[model samples]
Target: MHLRKLIPFIGLVGLCCACVFAQQPAATGLVDAARGRVAIPDPTKPPPLTNSVNDDQRRPRNYDMQPPTIPHRVDGYQIDKNFNKCMDCHARDKSAFTLAVPVSPTHYIDRDGKALQQISTRRYFCLQCHFAQEPVQPIVGNGFENVDALAKKAADASQAGKK
Candidate 1:
């Protein structure tokens, strides 16, 4: 009957409204919007907008798109070892051997001009700023390709052609 259809339609409207206004509780009382008391958030829902991977799981910023992912797990590496795991691959001496780019020399310089022997404690937590890279999956419906990877391949091809 039409009444049955109306029941589902009414339920869907309520569900939508619930999602649209839900506010998290803080030390203060229930967060509320102008329209009504906000409904509870559903944990089953995928994260809402502005939610990307956790900051801990994500890579550093200010780099070109699609940097390679970190290969080793950093779970309990001796951070006291001068952020040593990261430094091993990303240091002035070992970068060439590890085939990894060293941390920028700027990272070694303190706010003062002097280069410190170790990574500053401020930069010691690798996950704080940098993260293992992730493969690029388009967030929207459109297909996109990374130009940098293509450019690198073209350069390699040109070099091979010359030889």
Candidate 2:
């Protein structure tokens, strides 16, 4: 009975110690991509908000299974438990008339893998998986290669090795 009463206190102390230890200086001199050189305890001034790219042109996906990015600005769009403004144009039944790409069929699948007539509650929040492109400079450089590019490079290397 006493151990059970003390368990919560012990867990709290352990969590505090873990947080302190986690903030110790990185031995590898790695800088946080988001915070840059600022220490963990220091407050960072956020960059100014940039305008979203609103050309309505679909950009290429960076990787496999990447959710499509919103091609238009979604400012002032209402997304709440009561309503989803995205469904106005992107719903399957309305996309043809609106000429907007329909929400993928996968969005209709429930956690149990059963198909629902409407968008699954789990996937109703479009912004959770999709983001509108912004024309802002990246804070950190990336050297990401898509699977298609990697596969083509491997094929070319094999052909060169045979020659």
Q: lDDT tens string, model 2, 1-163?
A: 6999999999999999878766764755667788877887789988988889999999899786899899999998998988899998999999999999999889999999999999999898899999998888788888899889999999999999999
> What's the residue-level lDDT of 129 in candidate 1?
61
| Cα distance off (Å), candidate 1, residue 143 | 13
Candidate 1 yields a Cα-based lDDT of 0.59
Clashing pairs in 2: none
Q: TM-scores of the models, in the given order?
A: 0.40, 0.77
* lDDT of residue 122 for candidate 1: 60
Model 1 agreement with the true structure over 1-163: per-residue lDDT tens digits? 6897799889999999776554335434544433134344433333334423434443443336433455445555565653467776777688789876677666677776788886655656566665544334443455444676678889999999999
Top TM-score prediction, candidate number: 2
Which residue runs of candidate 2 sit more than 4 Å off their true CA positions? Answer: 1-29
lDDT of residue 147 for candidate 1:
70
C-alpha-based local distance difference test score of model 2: 0.89
| Cα TM-score of candidate 1 | 0.40
